[model samples]
Target: MLEIVAVPAFADNYLWLIHDPVSGETVAVDPGDSVPLLAEAERRGWPIGQVWNTHWHPDHSGGNEAVKQAGATVYAPASEAARIPGVDVALKEGDRVRIGEHQAEVWEVPGHTLGHIAYVLRDDGIAFVGDTLFAMGCGRLFEGTPQQMFESLQRIAALPADTRLYCAHEYTLSNARFAAAAEPANDAIAHRLKAVEQARQAGEMTVPTTVAEELQTNVFVRAHDPQDFARLRTSKDTFR
Candidate 1:
């Protein structure tokens, strides 16, 4: 089995540490800062052998150079290689990466950035989505268009309902508020809002949300079409 750990950094960012016990291989995903990531890995006695980047954003690939210096091979999106630091392998859609015996397929999920990608481990039923798909929201359209984001989200929604998404940030509380406003009549959104509120108030993480849960509550994921998604994205940008 793959063992995953979430390492919090810079207030909201979550850097994932994935370990495959069988192969004793460890990988760091979207490590914005090398300090916390290195500390966490050392504490767990797991030497990171690979660093997988989702995009060229500073807060996602800033630690690439440092991690690579520590002897980890760096893999980043092919389209954004020039912008990202220390990219040894440029991955595109359908490319595969492995940790121990588990393999993850690369998926182009641009929205937050034009070259953003996701790592999906089908056998494990989990996906490290970077900033593309959040718990109840999606990434801001920094370099991609609403149409592209909508298509990316639809691809994610098509995954089995049980698929667990590990997004980069903890934006669930604020996203729930927007979701409630977007679908005031949705009992699911309302109920999820209440739950999210409690979780945040109690200082708990509300991520690793399942596809089924997002389908029922995420306004963007529930959008009727690309136009609808565009409106929701615009609203979220100005919300609160």
Candidate 2:
């Protein structure tokens, strides 16, 4: 079985650790920092074999050098290989990254960044989507155009309804607030906001949101089309 644990890093970033219990092999994703990640590997007695980065952002690939020193093969999207430091393997869409006995499919999910990608583990029913799709919102268009981002969301929405999203940042509470503003009549979003607030108060994570739940409450996923998505995105950019 594959086990996933969240390693809180930076201010709100989450460095995810996925392991195959039987083989004691682990893969760390979007490691903003290495100290905490390396410590966790030692705590679990698992050898780090793979480090996957969804984008070339510093907060995502900052730990690449340190991880390489620990003997982990770092993989990043082929599009940003030139910008991603210490990338041992550059993967493209449709490429499979084997971890122990399982595999994760690389998907080109640009929008948050020009070369952003998502790693979908079908058998595990989880997808590490980086900043592309958040709990109730989507990433700000930093590199790709709004239309590109809308298409990216559509691709992710095509995944199984049961697919669990493992976003890199902990933005659920704030995103829900925006969702509430965009769809004031959405009782599902209001309910989720309350639940997420409680989870935060208890020092718990509100992540691994199901695709079904996002479809119901997430404005980005529920956007009618590219133009609608662009308008919502523009609103979010200046929400605060």
TM-score for each candidate, following the candidate numbering: 0.99, 0.98
Q: Which pairs clash in the backbone of model 2?
A: none
Per-residue CA lDDT of model 2 for 2-105, tens digit only, reads 89999999999999999998777899998889999999988988778899999999999999889889999999999999988899999999999988888899
After superposition, the stretches of candidate 2 with alpha carbons farther than 4 Å from their true spots are: none
Provide the lDDT at 23 for model 1: 90
Backbone clashes in model 2 = 0
TM-score of model number 1: 0.99
| Model 1 residue 100 CA deviation in Å | 1.2
Give each model's whole-structure lDDT.
0.94, 0.91
> Against the true structure, whose TM-score is highest?
1
Tell me the tens digit of each residue's lDDT in model 1 across 1-240. Answer: 888999999989999999988998999999899999999999999999999999999999999899889889999999999999999999999999998778899999988899999999999999999999999999999999999999999999989999999999999999999999889999999999999999999999998999999899989999999999999999999999
Off by over 4 Å in 1: none
Report RMSD for candidate 2: 0.9
